[model samples]
Target: MESAETNTVSQDPKKQASYNTVETMEEVNDSPVEEVRLTVAITDDPTLPCLTFRTWVLGVISCAALAFLNQFFVYRQNALSVSSVSAQILVLPLGKLMAATLPTKAITIPGTKWSFTMNPGPFNLKEHCLITIFANAGVTGVYAVNIITIVKAFYHRRIDPVAAMLLTHSTQLLGYGWAGIFRKFLVDSPYMWWPANLVQVSLFRALHEVEVRPKGGLTRLQFFTAVSVSSFCYYIIPNYLFPSITALSFVCWIWKDSVTAQQIGGGIRGLGLGSIALDWSTIAAFVGSPLATPGFAILNMLVGFILIVYVVVPIAYWNNFYNAKRFPIVSSHVFDATGAPYNTSLILTGKSFEFNREGYDSYSKVNLSIFFVLIYGLSFAVLASTVSHVALFHGRTIWQQTKASFNDKFGDVHTRLMRKNYEAVPQWWFHGLLMVVLAVSMLACEGFGRQLQLPYWGVALAMALAFVFTLPVGVIAATTNQPAGLNVISEMIIGYMYPGKPLANVVFKTYGTISMSQAITFLSDFKLGHYMKIPPKSMFLVQLVGTVITSLVSFGTAWWLLTSIDYICDQSRLPPGSPWTCPGDDVFYSASIIWGVVGPLRMFGKLGLYPGMNYFFLFGLAAPLPVWYFARKYPDRKWISCINVPIILSGTMGMPVAKAVNSVSWFTVGIIFNWVVYRRFKAWWARHNYILSAGLDVGVAFMGTLCYFALQYYNIAGPSWWGLNIDDHCPLAKCPTAPGIQVGQCPVH
Candidate 1:
């Protein structure tokens, strides 16, 4: 699990030489002499600050102050007054000050006496990429937006802050620990090729290889001075003063105006109608491209949103969509005029809106077409993953070769940095135990715990069923969602089939096999890093720390600064619309009820198995098999990477506008910092690129803290017309008071 490179770097040549001589001499004199070896030599490097009591105290105090300030000045402002701006913008700039002031040591080039550290901060490139991707769509993806919201909504009274915090830290530690146990399978194996790590390493190496050495002390001071000033400016500028995005939407608007833009625009309208049909494969191809411009996938999603906002609700206009007394959106349920919701409709809306609050809600119902498309994607995922796994790894040949190769090259040194497979539970047993605990917790924590309660046997059955079902689907979602938003349909199935048991449903559906799929995927990536000879233990520890921090900090901030009803009502009205709605969940629930009931009824009223959307997902699930088959058949072909079509297709649904100042800003950070590192320490960077990439991530994250506030905390409102105050009474027509639209304007042309 550790890298041989680290062992080599950490080894003390003089001490090791001395010990080797002593041991050799003793052995020469006495054939059976038992001897010890010296591993390192202690030396005082003034800049290599000790991690002593004082450091710990200072670190803790500073972090606590930072945390409290963030919570009070930043988080509280948004939570209380619903502000349009915040101070986190100010806070992130200070990170630059910290980064510059913190002195770091430089390692001497093999024959020289100089050293360097790239940047200071808690995150780095490899760290950020893995952390963000995971948080967004990897194993821990579900833990992001919705999970936190649901927990807060459902179990506010039961959730002790202390317990929640403890649980979070505990789960995180456990995740890290579990990763350690599987490090051999996941990290050191050459075939794993964690491409993300490679990317990080590349960035790091590139930065250092490009460093320009200073001629003298004055030049060195100037270099330092330049770095300090440039970095500070980089850290603060885009975050506070600039507006993110100059509107990339225009690129699609002008060039692809006819088909791509018009088609996508039509798709957005279709979304409002609740049925989206598009060629998944084609969309996948388009999205896989780096920019992911306004292509087919965007077209499909846009149509879905449009149909809902412009058509569906407008037709229901005679019915008051807002006033509980007149035109409540749900016909089956009743509510108090004050907007407090209850009953089946309330349950549906609450759950739906939770997904909404998490950013999955849409104004329209999904037509049968999207439902089938979802099913097809799901089916393809299952088939593709299974066949891929089988073809690539039958009888552990790949695994064995990887292990042998690593052991032959750098295994001994790695053994010291990363522990060997230690005493830990196997994957199956650990998950099995997890299921047991989850079931118990669900029963106790949920409102439905007391009612419609299945017997213990039923609980067992649910867990078993969830485990079995989550495998193919979870893998599909991972592969597909990695590049696109196809998981919405899969989620729909879970919502409707298990309706009312969102807690159990979400936990089971998301956690188990999903975890397995991600483990495999990331393990593959790690293998890539291993092949490239990046230090394994360094990669492992840095990633572990970064993931834990992002989860705790990012999730917490996202939860606290969540949008309110007004925000939702207003945001939903925007022309393009809010990302906060759960159209997928709505589609799933509606399909589940429609199919679960209708399909069975048509087939003679058999209950417990709806299988309608499941079949569609199964198609999606099977779609990948052929592509994978061809991949195996032509393994050497360059297009093999296209197997990630589904992911590319689904992921671009929400690529933060590249033109956004923030987006442009981060890329700027990457460009500038890499240039600096390249100019100052090119050789060292080439050698230790992984760590350097991590350093960049830290720097970027330090900078991002500002934008997070400026964008997320204060200015949560949509464009004015997008807010709730719409002019529904236009003389020519009337508009509904739902999210997204100004009264006088006809919905988008």
Candidate 2:
């Protein structure tokens, strides 16, 4: 299973200095040979400085920068995220520069046994790893942004800054406890490779290992620099100057008046069959690096995407299922039966904000597009299928790992090295931390009852659900790169229990779903640390400190943005081509209505309009039976076993957040790089694929953030010409032609 891309080279100076020269001479002396390989254990040296002052200083700076950049992008129209790899790339050069410049003199602590050097011995790999981990913690999308958006944008209410900060901090830290407890199942297992971290590992080796210029072809560093510079230069074209290149649907341009053309070819409003996107940000929006993902997994996701978008959505819309034609084909905004935006504020009682039944009845009923409805259906399916698939395929192995966790036997070479060299963080430590956070969370829930509307018992229930679902979801994410979310299920349960309380529903969902997902994210990082030979204790401390710092910094930035940006979430107030469309927040607002304001009783009740959709939960439970039965009935058929229903269902979940062009372009790139290139040029692909991905991601993110601040912030327009901002290249793509669709005026044929 090991490839050059996934393997790490030793970073010990003695080994690196001689190995590179010797290997090169041998390659030249002998005929074509297999490339030099190494195990996951990158080095046997045990004196590497991990928790150094320099590490903390760089980490704090990176944490602050990443938190600001990520929070800034979360509010934008595209919601383009800057990955921690950006920090990794930027930190290496900075760390080296610091190592070269800083004094090597040691500082002694009075009345203490501790003495440390400021220079920290050439800024070792362990310190670099810790810094990246710290940056990763800060770069995670803050879930509290949704809470802030809903309160200000929809409820027209303001929360105190202290309360908001506490809420954000508690929710973010609550997951770390769960992550620690599940380390045995998720992190200790050898099979949980966490494919995404492999990219980071590859990049780390490239930066730290001894540099040798390649004879003919580009070296790793040169290729990385070239790709990064090119990607940085190219992103400006699609990001700012020519926005239409992001989604160029030729079909829509050719047949501007055809409704079917608009439906099939419009990247924003339709399946985006023939649409082409030039923007890397758009291509990598929902799905991650195509070069990193496996070809088989991408193919499965594509199948699901086609089935849901092309077949199910179009059929339901054309047939007028739930009056789909009355609304936009795709939108996260909830609408009334008359095609007007549903105003939840009008139906709320004075200050209490409780639902007013009479007011609700006077207003039109809530309606969702066919695509939105399908997202819900698939969400339920994902929940059931993930658990069932894991049990069917991995039950015995999970049990074995569980039993083996208590023993002294090592699972793999990496674990053996870790056990022999490093002191493991005791399980009791994690248990103690979990209990402390649990108590604080409970108190926070009680204190914020008036604002969140969630009682102490509701908080307990949410935590309980998180504990129950964490293992299954974590397993899926660790292996498959897709984590089946608990958002839909949590909302449904809390909506039924505490009906008619929108804030309470979201609060419960936040604790239940977000905590579990965050825990899984932390566990994946723990695994990454293990692969890189970082001590478990140092990893835990860095992650904890980083999370706390990130919460404070992110909250401050969000508060500043909310106060400074007039009409923050309102699109009408922003000028043309403004990035602050708040698409993610809009989706959150819509969910609060469907599951909170309306309540599950009204939305999924026997007399409800979408009552049939409720049966999706039952369908999900049964759907996995056939897949399992086929796998067992024909055990020799390996492909049958590989069909993961949960992963397939994840493909449909992107409808609310991402457009069709993203998926299509992502798949195309994956096919070319992962499938074609890897199969034809295995050595070159393995050596360069992930490095190229990392470089591109970092470059685009760096340039995109720079553009926002330099041009967008100062209101410096690109150009007034159609070529500069061609968002409306195919103007009729959004035209309203069907009956009851009056939002957009269409030209007569």
Candidate 3:
């Protein structure tokens, strides 16, 4: 007569085993009720110093280096943002090296009860974690920099440095408050595994845990080193000497002047159907590492990518949707209907800087490629569908956990261990931080009105939207490793409210999207700390200090780049084949025009050009209903429940900066690692999959950073042969060859 949950709990026998011996959560769930325990042990070891001198020194250096690297890569033609996992991998050797050699003497502070040691007892795991957290903050790339780049580089507008710094700092820190509040629901629950963190956890355990040398297999460290050296060496070819090898489309080579060949084989300009990328950066650029992503999620994303990039985009462009034939099929650059680059400066009133109707009419209406139009439509669908998907799948579990968190009655072993051993960060601290950031935000908003024309109320509304969306978005991110972005929704709202004011729209979107994203990122780190059994108070301090450091270092680096590099972002000023094209900034500038200057009322209204795109929001809202119903009705069909509509749509989000080769390469590697090896060689895959990914990422980043500074910055040319510099191997690939199109140069066969 007992319920299913009760009966299962009563029957399981291995549930009482010590958590350290438990290999997986599935084993814990199979065990008996009385023996139920977490898969990891909990301890309250006060002797370990997390904020030691060594920790600070190493953390600050890593943060500065990563911040510089992230900002540098953001401006590249083929943008490649490095992950914090690079820091996570690189710091292990440095931490150990520091532990081995740093003076062990304690430095007594002038204040009471605050003596610190340089060695900090073997550079303990807690200090290691804190340093990584510091690096993570900076490496996550400050989203607010996009606003500065668009205004300064593309719009040719000047912003006060002080105001810009304040804006960046406020938006980055505002998310921490929400992250603190959502800790109970997102961080405490064991089910919220934060899939990406598992890779870190696995690496940490491998690094710290003692193991007898096993025969016939490489140890984790051995495998990591082997892969790192090989990857680091191999990257030199694709990243520098033979950059064209990164995107080699055989079809284009065979038929030089064929439009079909260009569409299918051009890695940078087309769908990249037959292209093969040898570079790790190109492979992992858009979709992330194959080993880390789950097989099912990869499949879902692949389905979306194939349908949109291969089928929908070609059809729309061929049919001349919104005169798509007049422009390149895949470009981030904004253009007028006449196929000329959009000149917003010409259309703006000289005195007030408002959109001038006379100039606008003479300049002609703006145009978007069919692919760009699809991106906006799919983005709206993703925004609405994510909420509905989460509500249907995780609503009940979230409700139960919320009740338990409030009652302080922890059911999960992980939660029990956390509560028993760690001092929870005081709620007042988070609330106080939130209030301070909000006040600073108001001042920054006033500065925006003076400098950028964004009204103060729009700033407040942006914060409100961020607050409302944070929890739902956090839920999705924690569970799926894919965070639903607030970029599209925020831009739509602010664009309509502040029509004809491009700066104001971007400012509002920055606060709204960055706040929500930063919160989710902070929460993910919290979950990582939880998995490692790091103290909550230490985690809180590290995040707070890291965010501040990131703002200063990232903004400073960006400003320095903008000032020092002559015509860095302007393609005509820089030498040909230069990598600094600011592709992302171009996209950001285009969005500002499409959503802000023109406004959605005129672009997607009843009488607008692309009115059909407006219904995408409704389509998003309703798409998940039937799927959720089917999932509930047939719960046994596991694959049915794995269909994540949002993650699927996310495949197209990177279209502006990524080509089809990235996705194709990502899926191929993912299939090899997650599906093939995972199923056939379970033990080997489990032991080395994450280690391999971490190694590749670290190697590529380290080498890429070195090359950029050593050679690229000095303008030293690598042998300029066709083989080495493939930048112009397929020039006609970028040409628009639809009927009667005479825009770009197409080769005559």
Candidate 4:
């Protein structure tokens, strides 16, 4: 994988330097996994300067820009993750132009002999990966800010700015602490290949690698440019012109008058049978590009999705399990016993915001659709399955890696190269940082007038849960590109232990889940660094700086919008077509009410309407046993090991927030590319598969941003017509099946 370049000391300040090394200069990348060999290039230019003047300038600029834009769009309806792909593509020319134009002069430290130059050699892939790392930091909007947003905007409570900053820093940096501790297991080992980073690696190489045009086919760069333009042009129709095409449920069109048909076929609210999405955002926005995911993982996810949505949910709903007939078949919203929308105001204790037992006793109990309840149940199952699955499949490898990492005796060439070239991050650094962050987090909850309401023990419990789940979940994510989240589990635990404290529950969730998520994200970035051969010290510094800047920018943007805008999140008061409806926060607000204000005790406990959901935890604990047993029983069959129960249990992970169409389309697309095309057109799939995913992602992102700022921002909507809105044309899907139930515009059942 080495490029046609000479290795020498770079005395010239305008060129990168490299040292002589012994490597098997094979025609292919040397790796244990086939995907890594096909995708990531195993090359290194150790002397290439990573932290140059342009890196800091562009890194900060990209971080601030991404943080601001992501925070801005998060409140809007149908928010998609504005990924670092947008920046990875846009930053190449800016960095090169800076390198080509800036004067090559060395600046001396005032009182020391140290000197550095602005244009230290050419703009290399290492610099680009670092900048993208910054973008990664900003792209993930501060999760703790959700706690702040729900507190101020939804709960109408005051929170100190200092406390808010503490919350943000503690959660994100706590994850960084975990990342430092787990680097040997997650980053140093070759087995933990993060599937998501393949897209980034492919895109960076396609943009930077010098390639001659083949006889008749387009090069990687040519393919990416063409697809990006085409995807950009094609997105307007679905994004603005005809939003209905995003989810095409033809069954609803065929039988428009039948409630049962709509309930089974509606793409947004129901099972999404035979539905397809023409829009890339509709497909990739929720679960990511199927092209980037492995075929086995997708198959496993499909199994779970089918078992739950196609099998269990229909049976439960039709039979009126937990009074499912009182509400819509599948919905994100909770309801009262009579099927009216559940209002948090009716069950609150006024300013104290605690659950009122008297008020609750007088009102109807909270109810959820069968599908929503199953999602929670499956989440518990996934958590349990993740632990068992990893123990069965990856436990021995992890133990070996842990021991070998102590002596720096990694077997892979990539880790060997990194060890010989760059210094490793010390274990004590991570340990010290973890202690500091843990202390700060405890103070954030305990201080601030006890406004957060979470006790010190709550923080300890959250940390313990995250610690227990982090390694297993990290292994799942590294291999499958999907990790079952801790949000529901943490919420359930906190709710049961300390009920009726909305602020407390959300804070606990943010701390517990976001920290582990952040750790995995950082570990993924570290893996990217390993593949790109960037310095470990440089990657560490870049991540820390980027996280600090992103937290500030994201929090500042959210606070400004909340304070300055009148009726920003209030949908009723705002005019039509307003993008400030705070759709994502609205869901967060609902969760706070369900888990915090009302508490799970009133919803799923003994006194609650549905305690059967608790049994799912035990079910999840046992879900992986059969799969593991069979894999062991049939040692020659390779496919049995890939039957991931955790992935299956978490198959419908994006429901309600993502809609059924998103998951269905993702499965459909993933199968066609990873399973079908991969086996047939091996060469083309190897060269352009991840590139196509990147182009479609950035294309839709740019076009959507353009449409929002140029047109939708000023209240200028598309033409008034049937195709102008997100009308899935399945109104009957909202109807309940039990006899004599009246609600909304649905026909009487």
Candidate 5:
């Protein structure tokens, strides 16, 4: 363990203010990681203001707008996940503009001595950071909303909006409490540095760059603006005027008549051997922009994809293992012996929503497409592999950090400065928030008009589970920036403990998974704030308010979309290229069926069709061992250690929702930018790569929203020519290839 007294750095305010100077930097004895030292400015302008009137107006506006737009876009084909970077970039000018225009006079309250100014000095970096924090809350997808969407859209059940609101608020607030609780272990400790936040820090620093022209090349802001404009104009051709270009499956064009060819080449139904997506949303939709991940990480995912899609899936499918031949080779829908859609209403008792065993037996037992089943198996493997991988690779570092976290003397320069300058957020604040949210959560589950069916103890249990897994998962994310999710595990636990209650199962999963997830997200932001030197109290207040506003606005948008749209999320009824498939929610509803309605007993237990899939847990648990052993023995060979089993296993995990084209295009972009471009154009890439990514996301979000409100809502379908009307045009690609299987539009094999 680090000797606290030996590592202590002087927290002199005067010394910290000169941190940008070389001499001051040299005296930073308790320095952090290399990236932090290089990128994050150690300087602290304590005099600079935050949470100004300008911050409130701009922050609330960004929060509500982003929450509305993101929720609106989520129901579309390529779920547009516009991150806070978009807001981080957009709000710079707005904040400055507000500072210039707003009244500068200080206003005092009548009763209290509190006073504030609309224009709080200049638009400093701290103000910009807080606005982005608001955006962070808006950008965090409301995971619990999926419970509402799936129940209403997929399951055709009634979920009271009030209950939905309560559910969402509780799950979100649970994370706030966790974030506050684990601040020392996850935030203050330099070892638990959230790597992903480095990008934001760099961007913030770049935006705040005082030098107009560094070395005469285009500035980051200039490059970002240019790309943003280009990306905006380019999307219209694919998103509207020529939709077919989104999926340019040339192989489908080559052999349009052959099912084998389409199945091999189609981007959605098939392997996507030569398929390419021109649309940015299509490319970066399902699993996020591949440009965000490093080349090594992308390679790990690609390897996993190759194994699952090419090797394991083909073998199982061709051999008809688990009767895979009856269905499409790649599918997310549940099916029966005849490969027809397994109608949930047939087996589910009305009113009560209970499972009917006789109906289930009469109609056929629930069977999944081999791909989706394998996805679940791999998900289980990912959880185990993550634990094993972290333990083997990062255990000692974590242990040391755990011990060191208690002593403030061991804190780094940033931490020491923050502690001396700002008042820490009391632990009781989070504790109180947790207690209040828990109480309200229990009330919602038991008192809501709709029978949510989750008992009081279940809520407590879910919170406990989330509380337990926060640190391990937080450590994985803090270091690798890849969140090994607890969604599957939460579902499994709830399903086992409380079987045959769909509402209860999803509710439990939402609490167990999203609470942990939100905690990590908040902690990540806290790390970012810690790096930026935003006051801890202001950070807490901004996050809490932003989260509240975001949740409210998101729920409002969802309610509006679900109510207004004609045949929304029902692909069978909606027109071709309608852009409201709700693929993610489809996956959620599928889980609700498998683990909630059906329960684990009949699905993966002795009574289940494929109990052998359970061995995946053991396989995942053991998969990391050999890699760990070899890395220890070989020591010098670094590549062996880089083979991330969790990421590899997760490569093809999103088959149905994220089509082959998505992965292919994501991988290609990741390789080009993160590998080739990064290697060849190191300086230029470092300056503009992440900025370019943010610019692209902003452009797409702006144009996509414009298209929806201006054209799609009015039913102004773009030119119905071959290029605009048809997508990929692989007629038989989405169809099953087995003989005598009749599906709409597909010829018999």
Candidate 6:
């Protein structure tokens, strides 16, 4: 998309600039631009009246039909392909379908012609969000985060959906606010590529190209028809006959079982020693950290294999087995430190375990404790970097850039490309507003989610403290995802402050802490988007809608999925350590107890908070020092320490196992597909490929909906359909008491 014409040589640097020359009078006259804005471009008016009833109905039906067709055709064309073309295949055809059938207007695209626009259909952010929310409810209803779900279900727990929405939305709002301040560096800078948005932009470009081109017309229709038919088949077949068909997960299963060898087995028997080596927590850490990115697979593999089997499991058994000569297995009669039956009859009943378990009684206390320590240390390090970065480098620059940006956007078009020179929101006002928002939300959450059981004052105090503590931490997470978001440490503080109220701790962590943290993160992303020429106001509204929708939908789906799992426990192809089954709650609990007791002790005593052998503290202080010193010393070296070392190290080490398998699989399929299309037909592939991919994603998604109903909801035999035994996968307590064996006896080696 680069401009073909080159700038002529000029003696003056200012005059020699390309795209700077004004149009000649004759040329300007020759170009009859139909619609133009003096300062900012407008794509139709924002205040266009809503469509009439007839039009609305027609639009909705068209959208549904299109959505179905898109999913069906998209997956049939090698659904597992990971190439940009595959993504385009999913976006283009859908666009073409809309263009061919819907009403349109001409719109100008950068570096291209004034293209015909298709109806965006009846879909808006609201509908997008709502659909996701319902999907989430379906997921959640069937599969709760086992322990947390069990606790809530048993307690007849009900969280206010509205309150959850408010908390998450507010956090996102804050993130946007903060992101606005850093718009210059994150958005305007060409080097700061948001890799995630690459997909969206590419899809848009590919789709737009085809929609505008006359040659793309027939292919587009084919795509639309394919997706429509596939969706219907998927929906009907799954609902009536099969149900388990989410295209995304289907690939994952194939990758996991047929392609990859990683598996989690049930009941006392580990997957060899390797089985004991992996768990959900470690999986999350590996996936989310830089360790799972490209170029880091080998390191992750070595680290993951070593840490899980050797370090973690051994350490877990240290106090119980190494010290007491006890084994990994615990007895049903054994009462853990809390005085509750560690493996009680309460859990033995499948009916009871499905409904009742409260908090975490799964992992050894030591494992939990380590998790607590790690999260706390990470938080401290994050806080340190945020303060150091802001105070030493960013403070003055932020103010100047913000003012310039404001003027550029509204004052002068000339200032558009230049750094935004605007003042940041005053710190006091910014923080004060955050506190006020937190306060209102905290009260509302407590009132709505009775399960939180938080005393009003305590809830307010915990949130206020969390907000205050998280500001610096949040800043670190905003700029770098490797943030110590005070998750573990914050839990500790809440645990102590609230004292004995686990559910309250849960609410605070989920809503109170995550909300504020996400707020900063979302805002940063927006700032990044702004630099890429996306409209700020639209971005804001879209995010608000997306967050609200995702929250409700994700949560709801989580619930539904949990219920469905319960309904068909055996038939599910889900792994034992799936997020639906084994969630991140363990980390939450460990952090709460570890910090709740010890963090406060450090304050009163001579020792500081987290005093002894504080590797995290050392890491925090040392981590940035080297980077800062290096950056200062070598100014001419280009970017250095801005890439957080720990994050870099983790990412570099962890990429292969998490990503390589998927990447390789998709690549293999893509190469074959590309060859087949290019060689088999004399027709050009580039023009039609994008529309084809779009058709695929829609088709897949449509099939996914069908799979959801068939496998998950409408199965005739439920868990018994495939003769899969829940007893094999279900936790020990939930399984029937073993024949000829005492309930409390440990398994023999």
TM-score of each: 0.48, 0.93, 0.92, 0.96, 0.93, 0.52
RMSD of every candidate to native, in Å, equals 13.7, 4.1, 5.5, 2.4, 4.2, 12.6
Tell me the lDDT of candidate 3.
0.76
Model 6: worst 10 consecutive residues (lDDT sum): 30-39
Those runs of model 5 whose alpha carbons end farther than 4 Å from true positions after fitting are 1-23, 26-38, 212-216, 409-412, 575-577
lDDT of 4 by residue, 39-86 (tens): 766556576788878788889899989999899888777675678999
TM-score of 3: 0.92
Q: Against the true structure, whose lDDT is highest?
A: 4
- The C-alpha lDDT values of all candidates are 0.32, 0.77, 0.76, 0.85, 0.80, 0.35
Cα deviation at 638, candidate 4, in Å, is: 1.5
lDDT of 6 at 305: 37
Give the alpha carbon lDDT tens digit for every residue of 162-207 in model 1: 4344333332332232333354544543222232333333332222
Cα lDDT tens digits for candidate 2, 281-389:
8877776888767666676787788888888888898898888877767767778876667888767787776767788888766788778888888898889888887
**Worst lDDT 10-window in candidate 1:** 33-42
> How far is 71's C-alpha from truth in model 1 (Å)?
11
Candidate 4 structure lDDT: 0.85
Q: Which runs of model 3 end up more than 4 angstroms from their true locations? A: 1-47, 78-80, 111-113, 726-728, 747-749
Superpose all Cα atoms of candidate 3 onto the true structure and report the RMSD in Å to 1 decimal.
5.5
Of 2 and 5, the candidate ahead on lDDT is 5
TM-score of 2: 0.93
TM value for model 1:
0.48
Off by over 4 Å in 2: 1-43, 211-214, 726-741, 744-749
